[model samples]
Target: MKLETLDALLAARAAKRAVALVTALDGHSEWVVEPGAPPSGLPADLLEAVRQALASDRSGVVEHDGRDWFVQAHNPPLRMLIVGAVHITQALAPMAAMAGYEVTVIDPRRGFAAAERFPGVRVDGDWPDEALERLVPDARTAVVTLTHDPKLDDPALHVALRSEAFYIGCLGSRRTHAARLDRLRNAGFDDADCARLHGPAGLDLGARSPAEIAVSVLAETVRALRRPEG
Candidate 1:
């Protein structure tokens, strides 16, 4: 790789942006594409290949016009921000980390957000809204609210609804979710925005225990990330 290209890749990584590096296997040409920016002068098929590589988070060689090209995907770690450091979060945080997410648990209640309770995970003591503002959930992020408290969960949802985060789930019963939707609608969120929330979160796996619920939530998150239309 050329020094300039290497520098550009490094900079993208530093900024937590998704970028791909494409190089001709015959050592003839190279291109760097960041999906957020319009890729100028790239053919439609080549751009589509880059999009596929970035979407699958996989790098491989592809053939076009009888010429081979290697596409390398450089994507930042997927992030999961859990609001409310309650029992569900206790199980959810570690499971999310094991699944390759950079997980962080947020709660203003310092006692619940203690680092010891979540050994290898990050615990934020700031209020839900404040913490989320600083973290800034992006397109590669998944945000879940495990705290049943409306005071905490509602504010976080307000911000999550406005973000590009791929998944947003909330822990509550169907009736509770209905009330929450009313609150969001009254607070100015449209039906389309409110629809993004996966309320009573997690797939219906007959989950009762914290760990089981965590598994369900994680599965739902994965589904949202991979099969968004469904």
Candidate 2:
């Protein structure tokens, strides 16, 4: 690896950009495949392999055209952006952090987003929508709204739906979710877009306590992330 390429890789990681470093196993020649800019010199079959490697978020050697190739996916850090600093968030954030995510709790309330409530988690004091816009959810990010308040959840949902966040879950009942879907439809979102919301949020775990609900949501999020039903 040249110093220049190493610098570029470091910069990409810092900017949270998705990139792949490909090395020819035979000659040790290397190339960088950015999200939108794949190497034109690569064969069509080789490029497709690269795409699969990136999607799988795995790094390994691939035998293509009788030549071994090492493809390493350099993805951004996994993140969980929890909306509304509620009791569920208090439980979920810590769990997400333990699961190797960089968790951020977003809410406008000063007391709720206080340091004591979220000891190690990053707490965003900005309004949900504004904060989400700046955060710019990507494929490596997951957004969840725990606040039942439409004022907070709706705005954040609007912003998240417009982004490429991998997962979007909302904590609510089925009836509440139906009403929320109606509101989103009225806001000009189509059925396909509204369908993206995992309303009634978690899995069918029959959770009762806040901690239990958080566990369920986390499980659902992991499912969508690892084994996306899409």
Candidate 3:
């Protein structure tokens, strides 16, 4: 345990990369190797401990006091795309951000879609389709529409249905959702594509205020993200 080895270990941890620590418990001076690096002819016990640590979900390996310990790093953050700058979105974006999501707010209206209103969020004032086209959505991304305006919400829904975005939702009443489905059908979206939308978007929590509605929507989004697809 020289200063250089300790520095390398700290550097690997800071970079969010996995590393293994080899120490002498009872053996004589030997070579030490980092995780994912070629291993030297270390003792059988140390080598076996390193192998087990790598095989497990843990990211780090420790050998001291005649024992080996492994520790796993935290998972990567999530990405959330909210397709509206309304009051509900204002509440939702911060909540999602606090919940460890990289929140991005998309609204075509420049007046409503500014950073001042939605502090740390990435605001995009372009049409949802065009904006999302440039920034492709993936399975790690959650997409939600809160405008309740067809002009903005419908196009985003269309794009999300075709993309691999994990969660797609739009806010509206049940009757309004039925009308939206009719329009989507008229626009050539079949039942399968339309089924991707979680309209009246949110859990059936009987939400009344924008903040409460945002919570329900966030809860449903979390469920959709974690649920295994059939």
Candidate 4:
């Protein structure tokens, strides 16, 4: 890799931006391309393949004009932000970490957000909205609210709705979710925006324990991210 190309990749990784490094199979030429940026002299078909590789977050070799090219996708680490710092978070945070997410638990109550309660995980003792604003959830992030309290969960939801986070899940019963939707509607979110939320979070596996519920929520989050059309 050229020093400049390597530097560009490092910079993109630091910024948590998705980019692709394309190299000729002959090992003679290479360039970095960020999605949505100009093609920078690459052929249209090669550019399209680079985009497809980046979108799939997979690195592979593609054939273009009888020449082979290797496309290496450089995507930021996946992130999960949990609001509430409650028991569900206890179960969910580590599971998310094991599933390759950088997890953070947010709660204004220092007692609830104590670092000891969540060793090896980030604990943010800031109000949900403020914490989210500072964290700036991105397309690679997932947000889940385990606190059943409206004062806390509601504010987090408002911020998550405005973010590009791939998934937003909230722990609540169906009736509670309905009421939450009404509140969001009252706050000016339309049905489409509200629809993005996975209320009563988790797949209906009839989970009864915090650990089981965490499994379902993570499964649903994975589904939402991998099968976006579904």
Candidate 5:
């Protein structure tokens, strides 16, 4: 109708808030409503048609005459969990943050697990098992263990393998990983569960320094998260 009304409608759509536009099409005016919004200026039967259009996964463009109305869907945020507060993690946290992960560092040692070390990263100075018990891991969560300690890493790894976490990796040598696998097998973890562990964690990039190792770990983490079924 008016320029200001069109501007407001566009602004609301861009902001991803629910809004509707009524325009004349085929000699009749129709209301184009977002999902969960009531229809206006259109026949009752056409309400279901509008709902189907809004529910579609594809980006929407409702055309009436020479005018077009757009509706956008909002995406959820990403979350990542680091199972250690070691040197590699110091580097990993910042890298994960840059890559849009809501990074969290979990450890029992308060001295090594301070927010000061991680800056903007969320630091949880608690035993991994206990902390994870309180905060259940979800499908969106990515778990990485950098502490070479079995006592700390084992409990966390066990919990992570059982959960729906997209990634579960542990830092160690190949020999160490083999031993870890043996231990997990003894602890009732089947081949399927053992398969989930990315031991000697990080890509096969021959990373030596903690920073380089962090990069490799993050790379592997991304790959694993993107391909959960693999």
Candidate 6:
């Protein structure tokens, strides 16, 4: 990689954006492609390869035009935004961070959102709606709302539903989820928007404890992220 391209890749990593360094194995030619944009000064055929590499989050060599081309993906770190500083969050935040998610816990309740409780994690003691607006859920983000309170979780749901966030979950029972769906409908969300919510969040592993429930939720998230979309 050229110094200029290395700088660009480093800058993308700093900004938490996806980029890739592609090398033509035979000729030692190179290119950098970031998410949503193709690199300039590269042949058009390699653009498809770069796109594929970034999507799979993999670094590999592919055969192109009778030559081997290597595409090494440099993606932004994965993030999990949990909108509730409750017991479940206490369990989930650490679990998420352990699994490579840059976790952020948000709750307006200062006591619940206290840093001392979370220790070294990002705690945003802001209202859910406003906090999500600033946080800006993106494709690499997974959002989970554990508050169950309509005032808190609903606003965050609104933001997550509209974003490119890969996962959007809310903690509640079937009945509660039905009520929540009605509220979202009344709030102007279409069927498509409502379809995104993984209400009763997590795989049904009969999780009773907070830690177990967090495990199920994280498992579901990982499943959704890694598996092919239906």
Least accurate stretch of 10 residues (summed lDDT) in model 5? 68-77
lDDT of 5 by residue, 1-230 (tens): 56775676677645545545545434344344554656455444344445554444234556543655443332234567888899999999999989878888999986889778888889998899877776677765788888888899999988888898878888999999999999999999999999888988989998999999999989988887665456
Off by over 4 Å in 6: 1-7, 26-29, 35-40, 228-230
- Candidate ordering by TM-score (highest first): 6, 4, 2, 1, 5, 3
How much RMSD separates candidate 1 from the native structure? Answer: 2.9
Residues 1-230, candidate 4, lDDT per residue (tens digit)?
78999899999988888889989998678879886884668888778877888788889998877889998988888999999999888999999999999999999986998888899999999999999999999999999999999999999999999999999999999999999999999999999999999999999999989899999999999998889887
TM per candidate comes to 0.86, 0.86, 0.69, 0.90, 0.70, 0.90
Regions more than 4 Å wrong, model 5: 1-75, 227-230
The 10 consecutive residues of candidate 3 with the worst lDDT sum are 68-77
Give the distance in Å from residue 188's predicted Cα in candidate 3 to where it truly belongs: 2.4
Which candidate model has the greater TM-score, 1 or 5?
A: 1
Cα RMSDs, all models: 2.9, 2.5, 6.4, 2.1, 6.9, 2.1
lDDT sort, best first: 4, 1, 6, 2, 3, 5
Residue 19 displacement in candidate 5 (angstroms):
16
Candidate 5 local Cα displacement, residue 135, angstroms: 2.1
Report the candidate with higher lDDT, 2 versus 3.
2
* CA lDDT of every candidate: 0.91, 0.89, 0.77, 0.92, 0.76, 0.90
**Once superposed on the true structure, which residue ranges of model 1 sit more than 4 Å away at CA?**
1-11, 23-48, 55-60
- Candidate 2 Cα lDDT to native: 0.89
* Residue-wise C-alpha lDDT for candidate 3, range 151-183, written one tens digit per residue: 998888888888888788888889999999999
Show pairs that collide, candidate 2.
none
> RMSD (Cα, Å) of candidate 5?
6.9
